[model samples]
Target: MKFDVAVVGASPAGLSAAASSARTDARTVLIDRDLTSVPNANTIFEGMASAACLNVEPFSIHQVRGMRLISPSGHSLEIDAGGHFLDRKGFYAHYLNSAADYGAEIIESEVRSVSRSADGMELFLSTGDVIDARIVIDAAGVDSQLASSLGIKTMRHPDDVAWAIEVDVRHPGIGEEDRFEYWVGSIAPGWKATFSPAGEDMATLGVFVRRHGRDVQRFLETFLKKFISRRAGSHPGLERMRILGTRRGGDPIAVLPGRIVDDGIMVTGGAAAQSGLAYSMRAGEICGDVAGRAALERDPSRERLSEYSRRWWRELGFEYILGRASLERLRSMSDDEIDRLFISLSGRNLLVPGGLWRKSANAAFQLTKAMPSMLPRFLLNLLRF
Candidate 1:
């Protein structure tokens, strides 16, 4: 069958691309390996901070806000994260449903390869089905094997991918209002355990690491037990809850990749390496919108597909870049240093980097609070740098 654009992965990015493409009256086909969830999207997205959902702010997340960040060093500072924790299942269902509703056909099958065509591209799927489309949208996340074939770097920088393991545990202490707590200390290297409210009567406990590290799941499990043992010992609700399931891995927290498209194919979402945790929680809609327009224009050329890249750049790229860079830079620091610095950017604190000029006053205050003991040493590092 022929299509205006064949999106290879019906997750947030693929579906969004399909919806966007269909909106342009393009014959879009969305395909996935799993027949059930289409792209077989699964994960326990717990403990959402207001900052993670910034890209879609003022839109679906109409009334969302960020609060203070608590550091492991026993310091809490006020700051604004400016995002929303998603109603995860609702978020996915909403977008996937939107794509289907927009006259887009979503199929369950996997593509083997993309053969060149005079007009654009030919996708050969395992089902012996040939989908001829002017453009192919690769919204497949993480192990984007197809994207790598097109010369796009699908592998995230070593420090970018975080191996995670989470338990859909029910905790009484963590309620809807108190669902966000990030534990970062020396107990875990290059990672932290997160405690978040999944929804009413449910919560999730998980942990992650920047790159190849020790067993993250072991630490996560240990932390989960300790956290639960300490907090839920007396709460009757904690014992009543049964572990529904466990989810792990496939999160890339890094800079958004460049060249999401090449030749006649375009990439979006995770396949384009669009910060997994960030996009999984938000930004799929805009990414889909961008890829959809490119397909509708039927400009399968690299230049045309590059527009999709720019579209995300204006829409959600900046925030992703800033957030990714900030996190990456923070990851390079020592654990003690991180704990100390996070205390400054916490709760509605309005952290901004205007260099030493505009933020001089705020910097002064942070210096005092962040380094009461190592004032001279800290100033020396800042001065030398």
Candidate 2:
């Protein structure tokens, strides 16, 4: 089959890319290994969902008012951030249907390999069929087959990838909670333990640990015990908390790939180390619009397709850099240091007004004031990028 644009993977990124490309009048196709599997549950800010043009209300299971940040020593801070917990199966179905409505062909086939063709690019599918396209967008997750076949390096630091495990549980106390909870510091080294309640008696508990190998199950077990005890007193009946399901995956938090765009191809989403649901969706849209136009213009050259990279870097690059630096700094600090830092800033509100830069600056100032020792390292980390 031949097309103007072909997107690999049916992730949020791939679906968005296909829809955007087709919307631009380009003949677009989206291929995935399996369309029946449910997507992992995730939470995103309401603004982010809107910005990505996703009508999340239909699939939303719970409305989130804010987040409670818990320190290692039990100190806590509340931040007001509006968002929602979505039912993944319904959400993906909605997105998939929307992509089809935009005239993008959806294919349930694995792309075994990708190679350069005289005209543009060729996708070798597991079904013994080949697809030819003027431009290709790789939105496959961390294990992107298309990227690997093309000899492209998609992760800057593989070891920095966060290994995570989450489980859905039915607990009596979770139904009334409106705020997401995050437990930071040594509880889950290099990342955090998260409690995201989806509905009354339905919630997910997960832990993300970087450089911790594959023993994340142990971390989850330990965290579950501690969390249950803390929330339900001494007689917290662990037997009553029914675990419905489990999911595991790698999160490329600080390992952003260096090159995402090349001749006749562009990479977005987890494959390119672009984490975050809304962020990846937005990136896919930008990539699709650029690649679609380039395909129609018959100019899929690296120079011509570099516009996607330029636009993405101009828009979300700073936020990514800042977040990476902050995460790296957090990873370097001891549990005690984090606890002390949280204690010092316990009563201070972090939801300040202004753009990302100003808010970040204000946060830095607040951190420096609370713990003067972190200022030098924080400044150095920010300056390193």
Candidate 3:
């Protein structure tokens, strides 16, 4: 098979790229395993909201408006109350359909390797089919084969890949009043636990721990049961409670591997390491859009299409830096120390950090604003290097 551009991974980024490519007048072929198993795959999540944020709609950013940040011991803080809860599967389907509507052909095959030819790049798939394209885009998610085939290392560290097991919770007590709560603890210290509505009587529940170490299943069982039991206190019954389905997987956050392009090759999406809160979906859209244009223009070098990196940087580079640093700090922090630190920052409407020393600057401003009385805990946290 031959095309103008070929994309691997049929998920968010791949689908969006296909749509964008076709819209830009390129003959795009998208390859991936199978979408039928997504709902059951460890990756597809339930209770993941489908509502897009109204204010950010124009920008195509995906995130819940409000997130309830809870301390491991059960303290809570809410932020971005205006973000949308995403229906991840629905969103994926919406884009996949759009790509077809826009004229991209969907090829349900797994890519095995990339060999550049005189005319274009030759992609060898698992089924022994050879696909030649003017440009091959790697939009595959965390488990990106195309990115690695081109010698891009995907794993930054063992801890960069977050591991988790989620169950479709049928607990009666989890309700609208529950809000979207993210609980921080040893099981998932860097991030928070999320419990959002799955249906009238249930919610989707999951936990994430550092990619480094944890008995993932044991931790999930222990914490989930405890959470359900505590929240279900005084409820009519626990006998009927059950987990509808189980999902377990990891998503690694890291920079793109090596070069994003070589020969007739180009990369995009998470494969290009464009996963973050504000830029995740936008990465796909931008990648697809750019890849299509590059194919149409027949310019596949790092020089002509180097704009992909810039696009993501504009949307996420700085904020992602803070998140990355915070994630690192969480990994190295003692649980007790972290508990105390969160307690201090909770509920404070201080300025959000804007740069590398963002944390320090914000802390200083907070100290100045609340002087004399002295925020002892906050001061102690600020003191910690």
Best by lDDT: 2
Give per-residue CA lDDT, model 2, range 188-263, as digits (tens): 5447889898877888989988887966888888888778867876325745799999999878778766688889
Residues 119-159, model 3: lDDT tens digits:
77898888999998988878776556775766655433434
Better of 2 and 3 by lDDT: 2
Q: Candidate 3: global Cα-lDDT?
A: 0.61
Better of 1 and 3 by TM-score: 3
Error of 3 at 163 (Å): 1.9
For model 1, give the 10-residue run with minimal summed lDDT: 38-47
232 in model 3: Cα distance from truth in Å? 3.3
Q: Which digits, one per residue and each the tens of the lDDT, describe model 1 over residues 61-118?
A: 2222344344555565543433344455556666678888998898878888887788
Return the TM-score for each candidate structure: 0.77, 0.95, 0.79
Ranking according to TM-score, highest score first: 2, 3, 1
Residue 278 CA error for candidate 2 (Å)? 0.7
Candidate 1, residue 380: CA error in Å?
16
